[model samples]
Target: MRRRFWLLLPLLSLAGALQAQAPLDLPQQAASAQPAEAADYQVLDFDWQDKSRQREVPVRLYWPAQAASAAVPLVVFSHGLGGSRQGYSYLGRYWASQGYASLHVQHVGSDRRIWTGNVFSLIGRLQDAAKESEALDRVRDMRFALDRLLAAEQGAHIDRQRIVAAGHSYGATTSLLLAGARPPDAPAGLQDERIRAAIIISAPPFYGQGAPEPILAPVRVPTLHVTATEDVINVPGYHSEAGDRLSVFEATGGQRKRLAVFTGGSHSIFTDRAGTGGVTLNPQVKAATRELTLAFLSSVFEGREEGLQSWHQRWKPLLARWQ
Candidate 1:
């Protein structure tokens, strides 16, 4: 009987743990989101690379008009899962206007345009192994594009030393990996060089079982982490987990890093578009996200340090919903 009781004890505890309540006030909690803007940047669209004439990824470069003379700092941006390079134009264009060169890449096979399969399958793209390959490919794409843009023929005026790699969600994962977050070896060819800084927005977890803490610990450059309070698809508590892990690099006293959490903001809020699953809500969330993103990019890329300092101060109060 004691043996039976002991066996049942573990099951009972497991059941209780499984049955534990998840927090309910997600929407209410997410009522806080903020963004600010300054000016408009020049938009340039061009073909980056192609396997064939028919299959080529298009790139959009946003360059601040004011930076035509000076060599502006550069930011290479990747979009979220099921998103195109154009998806986050709101951020790309704004960052360019702030005296930075923003390069937005359209990932082949993984973009929202090619993702017309099952809904579950589409969701799976967020953490798929193939997406990892695409991530590395994106880094390569950035390297290749940098060569073209900086060359005398392409007419680009960008600062090579201040290049930053950034993305949203799975795109954010790509940014981390490019900044030296290595995954288990795949058939992909990803070079671990060239990135000076990183900005990861609501990235999903790539490291599974036995993956070390601070999976992206090798990132020696400055990093900024941005996430919403209610990012359900990206998983619970992930923003904090990533922030904590990346902070190790900061604590060891090497790189400059910061994590900003917005209340009442949803996963899609970080995106330029307002809706994903046919639900439209929270314009405030989107606005705040873009504003902060611009300020961060400007500070890191364009040497606009004062704009970065005034960011949280000017936007914090607006983030609190019903306050």
Candidate 2:
């Protein structure tokens, strides 16, 4: 039980924190404005089976409706704990409209299913999802998805050189692993060399891990860290402050890394859900996040810092720190 307690602490804390937020009325929003925006891009759903592990990896791809003359860059996204592929459509749609293919991978073990069933069993489910096995499986899911996607017909339209790994919360930790973060207990060769950069948003510390520096020191790829001054996770006996995101940024091993800290927003604001932060500030932060990600991608891939600079200047009022 003690071993299980340690393993479950981080994810359980995250689950509890997110549960504290009001549920998003996504169904109503989907019926109203989501379809209008859907016209700008094509959303493709796939249920991929990794035969080796017998796990189902569900993904939603937001592809540009009008194909670009040149191969488009790809962003493979992983969702946070209790989130599905459908959770971050805003970012996917925005990226797709801008000529980037965003592939959102849903890790079954840690998905929304955990929120179902008897309330008494919730803790057990959370524990299962937080296990190291599930964490490693999330990484393999991304790797396998990439292999399959690159071999598919759409692969010809993707720019292999500009592939990026991105995620929020628990998913951000997964992105870090792909970007070369090596937790003390993590096995070797988890890094995916194909991912040239990473976008880590609201990433929590690897709880129970001694320190982030050694774990993140191996991450050599360019990275963009996004968080809010109020991006904190609170649950019984566990508390992760917004500064944890900065510690991660500081420890990450890359000269090209950038950090963006919004003035005020909750950790869940980055998800598709709305109203958990501030009614007005929620949308503003989302828009800024979308723009910041695009700017970061441009800086890393096109060698253009102008977009980053412009974004910083434009969103300066809402930002607590931009570095």
- Name the top TM-score candidate: 2
True lDDT of residue 50, candidate 1:
48
Please give the lDDT score at residue 195 for candidate 2.
98
After superposing candidate 2, which stretches have Cα over 4 Å from the reference?
1-38
Worst 10 residues of 1 by lDDT: 8-17
lDDT of each: 0.56, 0.82
For lDDT, the strongest prediction is 2
Candidate 1 lDDT, 25-102, residue by residue in tens:
333423333223454566788876645324456778887877767877878887765667677776776576567778
